[model samples]
Target: MNTKIAIIGAGPAGLMLSHLLAQKGIDSVILERRSQKDIEETVRAGVLEQGTIELMRSVGLEERMNQIGYKHEGINIQFNQERHRIDFPSLTNQEVMVYPQHEVIKDLLNARQKEGASIYFEVEEVELFDIESKTPSVEFTQYGERYSIHCDYIAGCDGFHGPSRKAIPSEQLKEYEHTYDHGWLGILAETAPASEELVYTHHPNGFALLSTRTPTLQRFYLQVDRTDHIDNWSDERIWEELRTRVDLGNGPELQEGRITSKNIVAMKSYVCETMHYGSLFLAGDAAHIVPPTGAKGMNLAMSDVQVLAQGLIEYYQDNREELLNSYEAIALRRVWKAQRFSAFMTKLLHPEQGASPYELRLQESELDYLVSSKAAQQSLAENYTGLPIEWEKGKKDTILS
Candidate 1:
């Protein structure tokens, strides 16, 4: 085969896969429909799991991340006007870093250029051919011309919108899905972060999270009704609502900016079984998607690529297909674990209107238990900081490369 792999989507999953495959002397091309400028301008997913940080370090993408990323020791849970801190390091012996997806993409793009690999930006018409056939290749368009890259294998790193899922016969795939009634309206500000650690507040009005991207940049989100449009909230209105939801007695004063971006992101989780057919393999959101509540999107994507990279490396070195066949099962186990965690965290902190009084009290009790019990705190700490990634040799401190 002329190409070892073809990865669609230049997001974290595709880029990371390209980087790792290159390390193993495997050649691959990344095709992304969006321009580099468009990707950098989009804001999403800032928190990084301890496992993800370690993985980036192993793959030579952590120096800049370590220098600029914000390190968070724990998260503060605010409920009933009382604030409780869950010390992540104290309980789990690990910490999370606040780094945006955009920055990660920026670093990956720079690194790929240095390596001179093929990452075509603004490409279109990405398709999967003979996915179930013994030989599979990707067909795409560049510069108004058609092209087909024959590959030994294809890694569908493209996200939820990519062609990986479509390539699978509808009758052969069963997609399970769940959508919540609430969504998040995120905002980025040029002001200093309000608190050192992310604050998740449960208020009668809604939910709020105070997070950061850099020392001088603050990123925050407000939980609102799924039907609530961003048009309903003006800059001043957003500030007023934020004040009401987060008033942590002595929390950092919020400085409002241009309301730089606003959108309602509905929460949902979906997974398709059997992520591979013949020579085609699926990775990241192309195979499964989880809500962003636990900041698991990027982390899980990296995890997916990690497993695939190892499997492909083994295959190239020794013609072993054992790990490759087990890839879907291994990745799905971790994926479901994170999905449950994210769903649990989202509902635990997000207040639902019209909920029974007893249910509301139970939510309070859950919060109280989390703060007052070491066992509960430890559970949150371990998951928050990220449990040791499961690798073939054994669990490791980091899973970067």
Candidate 2:
């Protein structure tokens, strides 16, 4: 088949790219290794940067999000038993939507299904060939058959383990990475949210964040050792830790449900140069990753595709590949900004495991300044709410030597 474009992976990044390409009159196909039902039930980040919501609205995917997602203008930061609210709108004149990632996937999947778009699921052997050569193709096996799906371009929206990155020769790339000693154990419960807005709390014990999937359902996480096993923590132990960290005194009790899901997510960030190899372009987690602290991972992935979609539109319509050629730098600037933001937020909110008393005091003092000082709060608010579009413009203009 002579598809104009081929998107590997059906996650938010890949699906959104396809949708955007469709709007620009570019036909593309998406390949996913998982079935639609399996993807819809998965749980993930619930915070939507203001720009992400706007992008969804522009693409007509916001109706379900509007009806089901919760909107939060502020988030409470608690320390020393004192809760302080950082009003996002007060600082940046913007608000975020608390929409779960899975819900967004469902919306995209349903919309695509209605359009009769081609998305191959349960397909394996996904490989990228001649990415640095002319006429790149994505080879995969389905239903005991192998086929070569060719396209002018390939988008590696696949996650960390996907083939697109590895397809590029090691000699052409430089990778930078940082792995943290800490991680988070998250849970989803079938109970009403304890607070009207999200709550991020730092205690002498560790750290915890209170968020929601919907008004009637709550989602939360606790800082846990990277090697700790989920089996070690009983349901009662989970609730006890949650209560100690998230209780706002007046908030509703957190009723525990089946553990649902549990994993120790290692805090790490990665960036590699030359996100493009000939006709293949990398977008989303396939390109970079961030610790969840700043809630920037999903938004960053979405932003990459937003620029990519625009670039592909230019490529197909005006026959201009300028945007396409600069995809890596454009995406990386925002990626690094988020990486810095996530690192900053993660360090600020989680106490160093063995911090000296003086160091602890310093962290608390900084937190105090962030909450009380207008300038500090505005900086956090602006980066947290969304990044400016112009950030991509300057980065894309510089030529790679």
Candidate 3:
């Protein structure tokens, strides 16, 4: 097979990149290891940064999301039995969309199908060769059949554990990482959300978050030991912990139902110093990962591909190399900022076990400042809704023009 670009994953980044490139009349093929049904049903992040929503709308992909997604104007922060709301619209002139990540994937996949985009699913033993060469190719198998895709560029959107990043020579890439001692035990339930807006609660027991997927489905998270197992937590025990941690005295009691799913995810912050290696460009989780506290994982991936798609479009249209050459540096600026925010949120909410009295008091004080100080709330709101995409001056106009 031959194409202009070979996208290595079918997740949001790769799919969105393919969609964007298609809009510009550029042709590309997507190679995914997971089955189509698997990707569509896998539940993930639920928050859509304002910029992400705008990008989806620009590409005619927001019709379903706009109809089903919940628009949240603010989030509540609770500490020491007190609850305060940080108004996102008042602080940043924007609001977040509470739509699951899988739904976005389904929308992108539907768009790709309508455009007749080529995507190979359930691929096995995928490999990249001659990445530094002008013409790189991806080789993989599907049900014992071997095939190779020769392309001008390859996008490693596979993920943190995928082969794309590992293909980059270890000597050329520098990785920075930090792992938390705790993790979040997340559960999805069939009940209405207790609060109209998402709530982040800090309790002596642990950190708990109250979020929603729909009017009838609620998602909740509780801080737990890193080694905790799902089998150890019964539905009753899970709800008990959540109820105790999120008690705000005056709010409605949590409405509980059968837990549909449960998983424990370790919190970590990781980023590769470079996002590109020769003709192979890394985007999304393949390049970096942020702790979920700031709700940046999916948004950052979308941001990376938006910049990448623009760079690729410029290269193919104007024969310009400046955008492509600067892709790594430009994307890294935003990537590091998100890592900082995610890390900050993780620390502010989840103190280490056996936290000293002073540490607990400091956490309370920080929450107090965030609730009382407009400037602090503004900072949180801005990062939460996402910083604007910094395209090269007039280049943004050129791309859209």
Candidate 4:
């Protein structure tokens, strides 16, 4: 097989990149290790920043999202038995869409299929060769059949654990990492949300969150020990912890229902110093990962690929290498900003295991400041709704020129 680009992974980052490239009249093939059904059903982050929503709309992929995704203007922060709201729309003229991550995958997949995009699923033993060379190729096996895709460029959207990043020699890439001693115990329940908007709670015991997935389905998360297992938490225990932590005193009562899914996610922030190695460009989780506190994982991935798509488009159109050459610096600016915000949110909400009384008081004071200062609320709203993509000029230059 031969193509202009070979995209590894079919997650949001890769699929979105393929769709965007198709809009530019570019041809690319996707290599995915999971079955189509697995990617569509995988549960992940749900919050969509305004930038993410706009990008999807630009690609004509927002029909279902606009119809089914819930829009929220603000989020409630609970601490010291008091609740305060950060008005996103009022502060930043933007709002977040509460749509499950899987739904986005389904929409992207549908659009890709409609465009007759090439995506090989359930691929095995995928490998990249001669990435530093002008012509890079990906070799993999499918159903005991060997195949190779020769392309001008290779996109490493295969995610953190995928082979794409590992293919980059460690000496050429500097990795920075910070792992939390705690993790999130997440659960999905078949019940109506307790509140109209998401609520982030800071309790002495730990941090908790209440978010809605659908009109009838809700998601909840509680900070737990890093080694905590799903087997250690029963349905009743999960509910009790949530109710106690998110207690807004006379606010909405949590409605209990059957928990359909549960899992523990270890918290960490990681980023590779360089996002590209020769003709192979890394995007999304393949390049950086932010703690989930800021809900920037999927949004960051989309942003990275959007920048990459523009760079590739420009390269193919005018034979310009400026955008492609600056892709790393451009993407890293946003990546670091998100990393700071996510790390800050994580530290603010999750108390250290053996935090002293002074440390707890400081955390409370920080939360208090956010509630009392409009400037603070505005800052949070701006970052939460997403900063404007700094590479908009590149996108316009490529698409319009």
TM-score of each: 0.95, 0.95, 0.97, 0.97
Q: What is the lDDT of candidate 4?
A: 0.90
Superposition error at 233 for model 3 (Å): 1.2
Residue 99 accuracy (lDDT) in model 4: 83
What are the lDDT figures for the candidates, one per model? Answer: 0.82, 0.82, 0.90, 0.90
Model 4: colliding residue pairs? none
Instruction: Report the CA-based lDDT of candidate 1 relative to the real structure.
Output: 0.82
* TM-score of predicted structure 1: 0.95
Which regions of candidate 3 deviate over 4 angstroms?
250-252, 392-401
Clashes of each: 1, 0, 0, 0
lDDT of 3 by residue, 211-230 (tens): 99888888899999988999
Candidate 2 residue-wise lDDT, 290-379, digit = tens: 888888878987888887887888877888988778778878888888889999888888887788999889988988988889899889
Candidates 2 and 3, the one with greater TM-score: 3
Candidate 1's displacement at residue 217, Å, is 2.6
lDDT of 2 at 16: 88
* Candidate 4: stretches off by over 4 Å: 392-401
